[model samples]
Target: MDAPRQDAWKDEEDLLLATTVLKHIREGKTQLEAFQEVAEQLHRTPAACGFRWNATVRKEYQKEIQDAKNSRKATRTIYSSSKSSDDTPMSLDAAISFLKEMKTKQFEDYGKENLETQLKKLNEDNEKLREELKQWEAAWNEMDKLVHWVREKRKSESGV
Candidate 1:
């Protein structure tokens, strides 16, 4: 008897898995919790989801995961150390400043990616235009030669 094949992971599932894991980590929750949540949504076993995340998805999103961890740690440290009202506001200000900086950087990175994609598309378009121009030039050269040949043949046949 043939064994049933396992279902392949979709891109959306991978994305959801990664984000859920990151969310759990940032909240100081366990991987098992994240796996359970993802499993319910994806209709897979929690163990299977955990294995997939640990083996592949986590590696692919290591940088993002680390960033989330660092952000959460910084927020925790700021809140925990603030005792007085003045210190509380100062810590809040620092957190706000950090958030603004992150937002700005995210926008800058997005803009750079957009520009690179546009540049690549424009280069492709320019190459296509160059090829078309070469074809048109060849056709014009052939027509010019034919026109000259006909004129000489007419003159010779007319004894001019």
Candidate 2:
């Protein structure tokens, strides 16, 4: 029992969504990211874009999706191997994918390094906090002992 949507997707919008999704796949980005990008362009929510893609557009682009994944794999292989043939000229798609792959690697490395540094700082802070807590606990125990001793001495002196 769903209400009818006021605005329907046009053919061009569907095409745009399809192509953007395929391009994102080839570039090693997720479909949700593609949906967000297309949503911004189409003035729709990402959920709407994702629904439209899965419900309608995606069925038509199955082959393209496979091709995009293969292209991404190929791009990775091309960049990872040092033994590519110099006689063979690289296509524009391959060149662009190569650059994208490199950029993705740099971003991943930076993220890992940044996370390690944060973890080191957090561990140091945690150790400091533990030491501080132990010191406070020792001080509290000493204060408790002093209070008990004072009360016992007063009781002994007053014969209470």
Q: Which candidate ranks first by lDDT, i.e. highest?
A: 2
TM-score of 2: 0.53
| lDDT of every model, 2 decimals | 0.83, 0.90
Instruction: Summarize candidate 2's per-residue lDDT along 2-116 as a digit string, tens digits.
Output: 9866788989999999999999899777899999999999999999999999999999999999999998898779765679766666667667767877789889999999999
Q: How do all models score by TM-score?
A: 0.49, 0.53
Evaluate residue 101 in candidate 1 and report its C-alpha lDDT on the 0 to 100 scale.
Answer: 63
Clashing pairs in 2: none
Per-residue lDDT over 1-160 for candidate 1, one digit per residue giving the tens place of the 0 to 100 score: 9765677788899999999988877765678999999999999999999999988899899899998889777765665453534534544445665567677878899999989999999999999999999999999999999999999999999999
| Minimal lDDT window, size 10, model 2 | 85-94
